[model samples]
Target: MSTKKHKVLVANRGEIAIRIIQACVSLGLDFVCVYTRADEASGHLALARSLGGPNAAYRVSSYHDANEILAVADHAGATAVHPGYGFFAEDFRFARRVAERERSLIFIGPSWRIIRSLGDKINTKRLARSLSIPTVPGSDRPVYDELEAEEIAETLFAFQAEQGISNSVVLVKASAGGGGMGIEEIYDIEQFKTVYRRIRNYAKRQFHDEGVLIEQRIFDFNHLEVQIVADRTGTGIVHFGTRNCTIQSTGRQKRVEIAPGFRPQEVDYAFDAEKLMEDIVGYSLAMAREVGYDNVGTWEWIVSPTGQPFLMEVNTRIQVENGVSAAISRVRGQGGVNIIAEQIRLGLGEPMGYDQSNITFDGVGIEYRIIAEDPANRFTPWVGRIDQFLAPTLPYASLHTHIPMDEPYEIPTEYDPNLALAIVWGKDLAEAKKRGVDYLDELTLSGADGTGTELKSNVRFLRDKTSTILQF
Candidate 1:
């Protein structure tokens, strides 16, 4: 509650920008937001004008342009920069520049050093292994040598073979590239060298870094995440439970997320779901402490059919599903947990006046990412103006979105067609699942593309998966 003098520069757009502005309002912090010409109709800009100062919204040429954002911050006299999840959220170089610039501004996430250290997949693997944490068997660092990369790939195939995996697979990805780019999978050891050289060449051309990471490709696994929070001191580490992110798109993008990772009560899982959650949380905290991670971050993991867990990577910023985790969590038995606000407070050198013992988890929370897209058609985006968007208001449901309900809005093609996030919670998984379906059924979202085709959204896809959300 001490950030009255601090002003925040919201460096992203859409629903995330709206959420950050709301968090700033709740924290009594001044804020400014920027948007390109394409996002002129975004609700975040309107919200800023209504709640913030006269100069709350600024028109920038691009959101990815760091100089544009910093210039706006200086012009607005903002003291901190909040990169809401995307854009510069995980860019350590941007964070470093924000702090090291002549008119230094606070980067509202982990410190620049921590971001740089954990942003690299190769370095994160090494760091996890150094702490005796479980990670997929792979090269801890980049394999620049072709012979060494092949050795690692061979070892991975043998490891998979040892695990009784019939179709052994190895994944070769550029250590520097992210978001599933510069990666390929090989089923045959004979083809390993071929794929390795190809990816290495691509990595050099794309990222200017020839360092390649060859690892055992994990398939048929449940994606889970442990949310970690800490203060600037790095010792006030605590977890916001776990969530099951298994149900994803054909491209492996999460669409529905439910808190309390595995529902042992609802499904007969092979692994002790509760204990596994605790173990992963402990491992995540250990790693966070090991690297002095000093803000909100996610420890992403993959749980195999047998319940074996492996550290996937670290997201050094607040994720889109963070509100789902907060929905199921309570601080000192009270429920309004806003993690984005916590990230801002902590990033500005605020104290975590409470610890893990003060926190408790209750009820099951679910979040459905509402997008103007067709799930059946490989989750292809639907671009057009939305004439109807009706968000239901329920006591147990919370909707976070940048799309306006009172007016028709155009679905911008410049960004992902993600329209909104519907979050609901209930006493248990059964009730939560029911409420989720009800929300989807009652909601109305329609739009049309240039061809005058009817709107196609993932509402049907989200409802269809509600029946199997937390089932192990």
Candidate 2:
């Protein structure tokens, strides 16, 4: 276990790349950023060069090409690689490759064995059951074909009848899928038969795996997740609290709030706040220990209307909304722990710096994911050259984006449409939401004026109070 981090390569793009670069700088480690030709002019690459000097950036044919990234890492003598939340972040093979590389390049995430186990939804649920953690009732095995899906659906319906639950729906999900893709909601037997094949085909095409799992869909439930960090020694600490990710559209998160379940007055929820939090944290830590999970991860769950929490899945990488938890942790005076830095340290076999007692959650933090898409046109990607881009300088708000303000910026058509993330903290949720929307309003991104072709974003959507309101 060495504390020294010589050089690290960030194997992702967008704000997360910039985030890891900043963390590297904070830790006084040499940082390298790999980019596709499409991202040659990305703000993340520019920032990396600015922070790490001339030799900080490299270009690859594609970000998803692991061989090219590893070649560059070898060429640059990188000791570690950080897959920042997407692409190969959860790829067990990639993690194993990095670990077994001749140079001994460390992958800043959980062990490959743990990633392989938890990456499969079916295995994750099975492990949860083994640990006595509550899970949503669903198919016990992979639903490969229509017959298996039909059988599972029948079993689910029978169980629903036994439990006296009517109008229940089942979620057909890809066992190896992520980011809310390759999932279909089946309402009845007919729908199950129709969607089962489609979901398997989708899973095959998207994730390269045809394995699917069915879970009882809990409607009108709150999406909550706990952030936890673990070390090789089995020492772990869950974050100060939970994040409410219920504010979503089309199964994707639009906004996330920390301590979301703290407001017991506004929403009539049946769960005991103390016990629920304990369960979430307890289950997450216990699972991490079971798998020898080292580094940062998130445990996501759905809280039913009756206050029962069902384990959904585990994310073996940093989450998109982790900034809200970081903001809250900083306000609690815990020395503003940098999760990425901690991740690198943990990968280097360093022990966790803090424990549960040291972690604290204070105030409210909210994050709005600002995507460069036309909401009026069904969220179509608004790709163009940015003539001017300006973000607010609010004290309580932090903007994470790779959209450059200086010079012309071209929005690549090859990647996610997410342009930026605006995170704000306040004394309470109301103020956090208000300031978050205000900060979003202050942002401006447009094509050159008089071109009569301006790029549209979802700023207005973030300001909609009705959309921000939480539903139990």
Best by lDDT: 1
Give the per-residue lDDT of model 2 (tens digit) for 1-472: 3455478899999899998888888877887888888998898989988887778888889888989999999888888899989799999999999999777788889889888898766788899999999988988667677787788888887788788887878888887777777778877777876788888888888878888888787878878888877776755544546777877656554444555544554444466765776778788778887887777888899888777889988898888887878778752365365677777777777777667777776677778888777767766667777778789787888889898878888778888778788888877667776777677767877773235676777778767843445556
Q: Least accurate stretch of 10 residues (summed lDDT) in model 2?
A: 260-269
Model 2 alpha-carbon drift over 4 Å, by segment = 1-5, 236-240, 265-268, 330-332, 376-378, 448-453, 465-471
lDDT tens digits, residue span 353-449, model 1: 8999999999999999998888879888889999999988999999998998889999888998898999999899899999999999999988787
Off by over 4 Å in 1: 143-151, 177-183, 189-212
Sliding window of 10 residues with minimal summed lDDT for model 1: 175-184
TM-score per prediction, in order, is 0.94, 0.93
Reference-based lDDT, residue 196, model 1: 89
Q: After superposition, how far is residue 186 of candidate 1 from its true place, in Å?
A: 2.7
